[model samples]
Target chain A: MNSTDSLIDQLAQDGAAPRPASLPRFVAPLALAMAICAIGIALVLEAPFIGMAINGPGPMLVKWGFSIALLLLSGFALWFIGRPGKATGATMATLAVPFILLAALLGADLAIGQRAFPGETWQRCLAAMAVMSPIAFGGAILAARWLAPTNLHRAGLVAGMFGGAAAMTAYSPHCPEHGMAYVAVFYCLPILTMAALGWLLGPRLLRW
Target chain B: MGKQTDFSGDTLDQLMASARAGDSAAYRRFLSEAAQRIRAMLARKIGADSELEDVVQECLIAIHAKRHTLDPGRPVAPWMYAIANYKLIDHWRRRGRSPIEFDDAADMAVAADTLASTDIETLLEKLPRAQADAIRMTHIEGLSNREAGERIGVGVSAMKLRVHRGMAQLKKIAEKDRI
Candidate 1:
C-alpha cells in the first residue's frame, strides 16, 4: 500500500500496538520535560514569594494565566500539527493576541507613569529566552523522534515557541514585576527568541 | 496552494475528514478522486511536460503526508492546490532550470527523471545527520524500513517516519530554493 493506506491502517491497529507517533505519544514526553523544568526552576531560583503570587490574585496570576494559555495552545499546535494540519498561522495568530494586549498594556503603563526603561528587565528577558529555548528545544527535539511533522522547521519553531512559553510559565512566578508590559517584554521576547532560534535550528534539529 | 475548480471541493473535503478519522475506505476513495484532480491541475499549471506524472505522484505523497492538516471546514481545492503548487515548483526546478538540486529520493516512487547519486549527497547535506542517514539508507540505497531502523538504532516505525519526513523536508527546501 502507499503511505496514506498504511497510515490509515496504522490508525486502526494503533490501539493494540505501540504504533508510530500520535498525540499522546508525543505529548507525554514534552509534558514530562516541562514538569522537570518547573521543578528545577523552583529549586534553583528559590524566589521569595512564589507561593503568594501563585495563590494571590496579583499580576503573577495574570502572567501565569496568560503563559499557561500560551503553553497549552503552543503545545496543541506542536502536537496537532504533528500529523497533518495547516492551522499553525491561525493558531499562532491566536497565540499572539495576549502578546498584543500586553504590548498595549505596556504602552499604557509607560504613558501613565514615568517608568524608567526597565534597564535590567531587557537583559533578564533576553537571558531567559536564551536559557529556556535550548531546554524547550531540547525537549522538543527529544519528542521529535515520534512526532512526524511535514513542515519540519515550522514544527521546530512552534516547539521552540512552546519551550519559551513553558519557561515563561515557570519563570513568571518568581519575578516581582506585575505589569502586563513587564511580562510581555521580559517573558514574550524570550519565547519568540527561542522560536527564532527554533526557526534556525529547525532546519537542523527537526530535519526528520 | 492556489485555486483549481475541476472537482467539487466539498466532496473531497468530507472524504479527507473521514480519512483523518481512520476510515481507510474514505482515504482510498479520496486518493482516487484526488489523483485525477491533481493530475489535471498539474497538467494545466506545468503544461505537458515529461515530468508531469512524476510530479503527480510526488503531489499525492505530499497530500497523504499532510492529510491531517486539511481543514474539513475549508475547501479541499485550496489545500490541494497548495500541495500541487509546491510539488510542481520542485518538479520544474528538478527539471534543471534552477541552480540548487535536491536528491530526488522519491524517484523510486516514480521512474521519470531519475537523479544521480552525487545529487542526493549534496541534497542530503541540507538535512540533519540522522535524518540524512535514514533517508540515504532507506530511499537511496533501498533498505527496507525495518532494516534501516536496525542500522540506525531506531525502531522500524520511526525509521519510516524519519524517511517520510525527510523527503517532505527535501521538498520544502527545494521550494524555498526556487524563491
Candidate 2:
C-alpha cells in the first residue's frame, strides 16, 4: 500500500472519530427563519397581495395562493442555500418570473383605470418601479450566490429579462391611452432598464 | 468490558456517537485528530500555497457543520479528501481558472506519500478505531458521503455529519499543537 493508505491504516488502528448531524435539520430551521423574515417584511411593507383580495377571486383564494407562493419561494430558497454553487442562477431566474408578471399586471390595471400619465398614477408607478428595482437587484444577488453559475453575466441577463417580462405584465393594465406607443415607451423602457441593471450588477455582487 | 481488546475502537465509536448526539467536547476531539491529515492531503494536492491552512480550516468547518451524515461503522478518510478536493476546485473556479491536472500517477504517488507524513498519523494514535476508520475512508480514500454511508450502513446525512464533526475536532487539535 502507498504511504497515504498506510497512514490511513495507522489512523484506523488509532481511532479518534466524530459524529455530526445532517443538512436537513439545519435547512429546515433556516427555511422557517427565511419564511418568517419574508412574511415580516411583507407585513412591514403592507404588500397589497398579502392581506387584500380581488373581488372575483375571493379573499380565501387570494390568501391561499399567496401563502402557497410564499411557501414555494421559501422552499426554493432553502434548496438554493443547500447547493449554493448550482442553484443561484436557477433561483434568480425563478424569482424574476413573478416580478415580471406583477409589473405587467399592474401596468394593465392602470391602463384600464384610465390613470393619467405624468400624474398621481404615474408617480405611484414610478415609486413602485423604484422600490421594485432594488428588490430585483437584491434577489438576483441572492440567486447568484446560491446557484454559483459559471457564467454569472449570462445568469444576470436571464434574470433581467425575466424581471422585465414580469414587470411589463404588472404594468400593462395601467398603460396610458396613447395606445401601443405609450406602452412601448413607458412599460418597455423601464423593464429594459431594470433588466440591464440586473445583468450588470449580478456578476459583481454574486462572485464566490 | 471483557479485557477490552478493542479499547480504541469502543472509545472512538462512543465519541462519534456522542458527537452525533451533539456533545461539544467529543466534537472538539474529533477535529483535533483530523486536522493534520487534512493539511497533508491539501499540501499534496496544491503544494505549499499560502492559503493551504485557510482552505483546510474552511473544509474542517464545513465538515463539522455537516457531520451528522456520517456512519459509525465506516472509515472517514475519503470524505475528507473529497471536501478538500472540492474546496481546491472552488478556489480555482472562483479565480476563473480550471484545475491543473497532475501529469502522472507517479507524481501523485510521490505527493501522496509526502502528504502522509504531515504529522496526522501521529495524532491519530490518540484516537479510537471506529473514528480513525471513518476518518480514513472519508478523508483519505476520497469516497463520497453517500458511498461511505453505504459501507457503514448509515444514512448519507449521518455520514456527512460524522465527517464534518470529525474534521472540526481534528482542526482544534492541530491548532492546539501549533500553539
Candidate 3:
C-alpha cells in the first residue's frame, strides 16, 4: 500500500478524529490587555482627565466614538488576518473606514473654526504610541500561537492597527483634549507606530 | 460504484464517512480511491512525475489525521477542496525554492547523491518523518504536496503544511549549508 493508504490505516488503527475550523480565539485577551495597560497606566499616572469621557456633549461623543469604532474594527481585522491566507480586500477597506470617518470629522472641525493642528500635545501622542507597543507585541505573540498566516507583512499591518486602536482607547481616558481633529491626527500616531513594527517584525514572529 | 472500493461522487463521501466510523476495510477502500483523485489533482497542477511522487503520501497522512475532525453529517467535498487548495499553494511555494540568495555555488543539490540530495536534502532528512518525506519527494523529486501526500497516504493539507515547514526549515539550513 502507498503512504496514503498507510496513513488511513494508521488513522483507523489509532481512531484519529477531527475538530471544527477555529476562529481567532485571542481577541478578548488582546482587548483586555490594551484596556488594562491603558487604564492601569493612567491610574498610576493620575491624569486629571480620567473619567471625563463618559460625560458628553455631541462633539465629545463623536470624538470618542471614532476611536472606539477603530478599536473594534482594527481588532477584528487583526484577528481575521492572523490566519493563513490573503488579507481580503474587504478587510483592508473596513480597516480604512474609521480613518475616512475621522478625517471627514476633521474637515468639519476646520470648517467650523478649529485649528487644523491643535495637537500641541505631540509629545503625549508619541508617549501614547509607545505605551501601546507592548499591547501590540502581546497581540502579535498571542495571535501567532497557531495562526500561521501566509502573508505576515499584511497581517502585521492590520495587527498594528488593531493593537494601536486598543492602546489609543486606553490612552483616551487621560488626554484633556477632545475633538475629531485631535483624534484623527494624534490618536493615529500609535497606529502608525504599530504599522511600522508589524511591517518590520511580523514576518519573523507570525510565521507558521 | 459496483465495488465497495469504487469511489465517485456520493460513493467517495460515504466511504469516507464509513471510515470515520472505524471500518478499517471501508477506510482502506476510501483511502485508495481518494488517493487516486488526489493523484490526478496533483498531476494536473504539477505536471512532473518525480516531484509529485512524494507529496501523495503526505496528503494521505493528513487526511487520515484530520478524518475525525470532520463533521460526519456534512459534505466532504468542501473540506477536501480547501485542503487541496492549501496543498497546491504550499507545493508551489516550495517549488519556488528560495533561489539560494547567498551561496556562490548556489547549487541546491550539494554533496553526495545527485541520484537525490542537496544541502536541502540533508536538512530535509532531519525533519519529522511526514515533513521530511514530503520534502524529499517534492523538493528533491519535484512532486506537488498532493502528489507527495498521496504517495505516503496523508491529507493534502497536512502534506502542504509539512512541505511548507520543511521548506522553511531548509531555508534556515541552507544558510548554514552554503558552500
Candidate 4:
C-alpha cells in the first residue's frame, strides 16, 4: 500500500458518522428560539396571548403564515449551503419565494388603493425583533458551525434570515397590525438586517 | 477513479453508505478512491503535485470530521467533492499567505530555523517601533523576555506582550499582502 493507502486505512479505522439529512436538525433550534421569544413576549413585552384570541386569530395566522413560510424556506437554504457541494442556484431561488410573495401581496395592497402607514408601534416591532434576533442567530450559528459550513457568508446570511423569521413568527401574536405594508417593512427589514449582519460577521465568525 | 481501487462493482454512494454504517473495509476503499480523485482534481487546478499530499490529507480529515453532516440520501460524490473543493480553497489561501519558507537544504534547514533574521527583519519592519524592537530582541536576537525587557527598558510581561502583538500584526500583514 502507498502512503495515501495507509492514510486511508488509518482514517477508516475512525469510521464514518452517517447522519440523516440536515433539514430536520434545523427544527429543534428554531423551536427553542421561538419558545424563548414567546416567553419574552409574554413576560417582558407583556403582550397578552389571550388578547390575540379576542382579536380573532385571522391577522395572527396571516403573519404566522408569512413568517413561518420564510423560516422553513430559509432553513432549507441554510441546510443546502451549510454543506460544501450542496449549494445550488435552486436553493437560492427557493429562498426568494417568500420575499417575492410578500412583495406581491404588498403591491396588491397598494394597487387596491390601501393606504400604507408605518404603524405607530412599528419601531417597537423592530426593537422586539432586534432583541430576539441574537437568540435565533446564536442557535442557527451553532448549528451552522457544527455542520462545518464552507460558504461562511451565505451560511451566515441564511442563519440570520432564519433568526429573523423565527423572531417574526414568535412576535406575530404580539403584533395586532394587519397591514401588508407593515409586514413588508417591519418583517423584511429585520430579516435583511440580520442577513447583512450575518454577511459581515460570517467571514470572521464562521471561519473554521 | 484511477488505479487507486477497483470501484467497478460498488459505486461511491454504496461505499459511502457502507462506511457510514461502520464497515471498515468499505470505508478504507472509499477514502483510497477519494484521495486519488482529489489528487487528480487538485493537480488539474494547481498544475503541480508539489503540495498535493498536504491538501489531500486535509480533505480526508475534514471529511472524517464532518461525516455526520452528509445525508445518506444524497449522492456521496457531491458532498465529497464539495469538501475537497473547500479544502482546495483553503490550500490556496494558506499557500498564498504562508508565513515562513523553510528551504530544506540539509545545511541550511538546521542552522537558523528560528533565527531567520533577515526575514524577521523585513517582517518586523512593518510593526510599530516598540513592537518591532521587542520582537527583534526576543526572537531574532534569541534573548529571553526578561533580558529583552531590561534592554528595551520595559517590564517582562510588557515585552512579551509586544512580541506577541508584533507577531500577530506581522501575520496579518503577510495575509493581506498575499491576497
Among these predicted structures, which one has the highest DockQ?
4
Query: Residue B53 deviation, candidate 4, in Å?
Result: 1.3
List model 4 lDDT by residue over B1-179, tens digit each: 33433233447777886776678888888888888888888755543333567888889888887887776556677788889888888776765576543222432232254334435567777777877787667666878878987764555645555665666677666666656
Q: After superposition, how far is residue B104 of candidate 4 from its true place, in Å?
A: 19
Q: Candidate 4 lDDT, tens digit per residue, A1-208? A: 7676777878888877565555556566767777887788777766555436655876577688888998888877776777777755788788888888878888887888865388567887898899998798877887677677888888888889988998888777777676678887888888899988988787677766
Instruction: Summarize candidate 2's per-residue lDDT along B4-47 as a digit string, tens digits.
Output: 22234544445555554556566556565566777777666554
Global Cα lDDT for candidate 1: 0.65
Indicate whether candidate 2 or candidate 3 has the larger DockQ: 3
Alpha-carbon interface RMSD of model 2? Answer: 9.2
After aligning candidate 2 to the native by TM-score, how far in Å is the CA of B13 from where it should be?
A: 12
True lDDT of residue B87, candidate 3: 59
Task: State candidate 1's TM-score.
Answer: 0.56
TM-score of each: 0.56, 0.36, 0.60, 0.71
Q: Model 2's DockQ?
A: 0.05
Scored against the true structure, residue B100 in model 2 reaches a CA lDDT of: 35
Full candidate order by lDDT, most accurate first: 4, 1, 3, 2
Clashes of 1: 5
The most accurate candidate by lDDT is: 4
Q: What's model 2's lDDT at A27?
A: 43
Candidate order by decreasing TM-score: 4, 3, 1, 2
The deviation in Å at residue A91 for candidate 4 is 1.8
